[model samples]
Target: MKSSIVAITLMALFTKSFDPQPELINKGNSWNKNPVIAHRGAWKKNNLPENSIASLKEAIRLGCYGSEFDVHMTLDSVLVINHDADFYGLHIAQVTYKELLTKKHPNGENIPTLEEYLKEGIKQKKMKLILEIKPSKNDPERDQKLTDRAVAMVKKLKAKEWVDYISFSYDVLKRILVLDPKANVAYLNGDASLEKLKADGFYGADYHYSVYQKGEWFAKAKELNLTINAWTVNSAEDMKWLLKNKVEFITTNEPELAFETIRAVQSGN
Candidate 1:
C-alpha cells in the first residue's frame, strides 16, 4: 500500500510538470505608444510582401500597437496566413498545405502557417497579434471548422493573451465567443449598430473608416462604452479624423505616416 501511494504521487507531479495550465504569456508587457495597428504587418514603405513574416517583424520593429493578418484553412485543414481566398491563383481551400507552399511570396518567403506566425508573435511581449479569420462566404461549415481549428491552435500553443480575433462573419465571431467567452473579439463587417454589438458581447466594432463617417457611430460607440477601431485608413486626413475622435485603434498600411500624424495632431501642428 505504501509503495502504491508513493508511485501515484510521483506520477501526478510528472503530469503537472508536463501539462501546465494556460495563462497570459504577456501579462505585464508595456502598452504600445500609439493606437496604430499595421494593416498587414508593415509592408508598404519597405516593399515587403504583405502577410509575410518579414512584414510582421517590421511592424514589431516599428513599435505598432498590433499587426493584423488573415487566416485561412487549406483543404487539409492546415491554417495558413494570407489576405485572400486565392493565393497566386491557387484556391486555398482546394489545395493542400504542401501544394500551396510551392509558390514563394514576392519577398521570397514561403507563405507562413498560422502556427509559424504565432510562434514569431509570441517571442515579443509588446505587439498584439490581430488575427482575422477569413470567412468562407459560400460555405458556413468551412467557416466553423476554421474557427474551431484556429481557436484550438491558439489554445494548444498557450497564446490566448497575445492574440485578438476579428472577422467579417457574425457567425464566426459568435462562435469564437462560444469557444472562449473571455476572448477579445471584434466585428469587422461594419454594418452592425453599436447597440447590436454591445448586446452581442463584442469587444469592439472594427469597421471601415467610411462606416463611421456615414453615421453618428463615433459618438454612439463612446456613449455605449464600446471600443472603436477603424480599418484600412491610409490617408492622412482619415487618420486625423479617427485620431481626433479618439478611436482606440486605427488599422493602416502606412504605420510610419500614421505615427507622424499622431505626433502632429498631439502637438497641435
Candidate 2:
C-alpha cells in the first residue's frame, strides 16, 4: 500500500511540474516596447512577398514585438514557411521541398525552410517569431506530423526563446504543450472561450477582433490574466478600440499605423 501511495505521489508531482502556469511562460524574456505584431511580417507596405526572409527582416527593422508567419511540412518531410497550403497553385504538402523551391517569392527568394527562417530571426533578440502551424486539410496524421516536426525543429535550433506559437488548430496547440509545456501558445480559431483556453494550459487568447466585440471576452480575458491578442487588425478605429481596452498584442498588416495609434492612445489624443 505504501509503495502504491509513493508512486501516486511521484506521478502527481511530475504532472504539476510539467503543467506550467501561463504567467510563468517566457518569464525572463523582455519583449519589444509596443504591442504591435507584424502579420506575415511587415510585407504589406513594401509589397514584399509574405513569409519571405526579406519581409521577416522588415518586421524586425520596424521593431514590432512579434512577426507572425505560417509553417507547413512538405511531402518529403521538410518544413517550409508559407501562409497558404498552396504555393503558386501547387499544394505544399503534395510536393517535395525541392519542387516547391522551383518557384520563388516575387522578391526572388525561395520559400524559406523553417530552419532558415529561425536562423535569420535569431540574429536579433528584441522581436519574436510567432509561428502559426497550419493544419493539414483533412489529414489528422499529417497535422500531428507537422506539429511534431515543427516543435522538434524549434528545439533543435534552440529558437524556443525567440519563438511563440499561434494556431487555428486546437490540436496543434495542444500538441505543442505536450512537447513543451512552458511554451507560450495562443489559439487563433476565435471560438474557444478564455476559460477553456486557460484550463487547457494556453497562455493567451488570440481571437479575431470581431469575436471580442460580440461578447464580454475582453473583460473576461483581463480578469483571468490571459494575454489578449487580436489578428489582422488594420483599421485605425479598430486599433483604437482594442488599444483603449488595453489588449496585450495586436497582430496587424499595418504595423506602422499601429505604432501611430499606440502613440496617440498613450497620449490620450
Candidate 3:
C-alpha cells in the first residue's frame, strides 16, 4: 500500500510540474506593453502562408504579444489548425486525418495537428497562443465536442497560462467557461452587450474596430474592467485610434506596420 501511495504522489507531482501557465493571467492594463497580436500567425507581410507553423514561428521571432490561429476538428476527432472552412476543396469537418495528410499548406507543411501547434508554442514562452475555435457549419454537436477536446488538450499540454480562447459562437464561449472558469475567453461576434459580458463573467471583448467606433463599448469595457481587443485593424489610422483609446490588444494582419505605428505614437510622432 505504501508503494502504491508513493507512485500516485509522483504522478500528481509530474502533472503539476508540467503546467505551462505557472503565472497569473494578465488582465490587460497599462503594464501590458506587448499588445500586438499576429493574426493568423503573421501571415500577410512576408508572404508566409497563413495558419502554417512557419508563420507561427515568424510571429514568435518578431516578439509579438500573441499568435492567433484557428482550429477545426476532423471526422475522426483530430484537431487541425487552419483558418478556412475548407482546405483545397476538402472540407475539414467531413474528412479524416489520414486524408488531410495527403494535402499540404501553401508553405508545403502538412496540415498541423493541435498538438503539433501547441508543441511549437511551448518552445517559446514569450507569446500567448490566441486559439480561435472555429464553429462547425451546421454541426452544433461537433462544435461542443471540439470545445471540450480543446480544453482537454490545453490542460494535457499544461498550457493554460499561455493560451486564450476566442470564438464567434456564444454557445462555445459559454462551454469554455463551464469547462474552465479561469480560462481567458473573448466573445468574437462583436454584438454581446458589455453588461451581458460582465454578467456572464467573460474575460474580454474581441470585436471589429467598427464595433468599438459605432458605440460606447470601449468605454463600457473600461467601466466594467474588461479587456478590449480589436481585430484586423491594419490601417495606421485605425491603429492610432485604438492605441489612443488604450485597447489592450490589436489583432492585425500587418504586425510590422502595427509595431511601426505604435513606436511612432509613443514618440509623439
CA displacement after TM-score superposition, residue 169 of candidate 3 (Å): 0.3
Answer with 1 or 2, whichever has the higher TM-score: 2
Which pairs, if any, clash in model 2? none
Residue runs of model 3 more than 4 Å from their true location after superposition:
1-32
Q: What are the per-residue Cα lDDT tens digits for candidate 3 across 92-122?
A: 8889999989898777899889999998987
Q: Report, for every candidate in turn, its global Cα lDDT versus the true structure.
A: 0.86, 0.86, 0.84
lDDT of 1: 0.86
lDDT of 1 by residue, 1-269 (tens): 99988867765553333221113223566646467899989999999999999999999999998999999999999999999988899999999999998899987899899999999998998898999999987999999999999999999998898889999999999999999998878899888888998999887899998888887886787677677889999998999888777677899999999988876765466
Candidate 3: residue 91 Cα off by (Å): 0.7
Which stretches of candidate 1 lie above 4 Å from their native place?
Answer: 1-27
Residue 227, model 3: Cα distance from true site in angstroms: 0.6
| C-alpha positional error of residue 78 in candidate 3 after TM-score superposition, expressed in Å | 0.3
Comparing 2 and 3 on lDDT, the stronger one: 2
TM-scores, one per candidate: 0.88, 0.89, 0.88
Winner on lDDT (1 vs 3) = 1
Q: After superposition, how far is residue 226 of candidate 3 from its true place, in Å?
A: 0.4
Candidate 2: residue 26 Cα off by (Å): 1.3
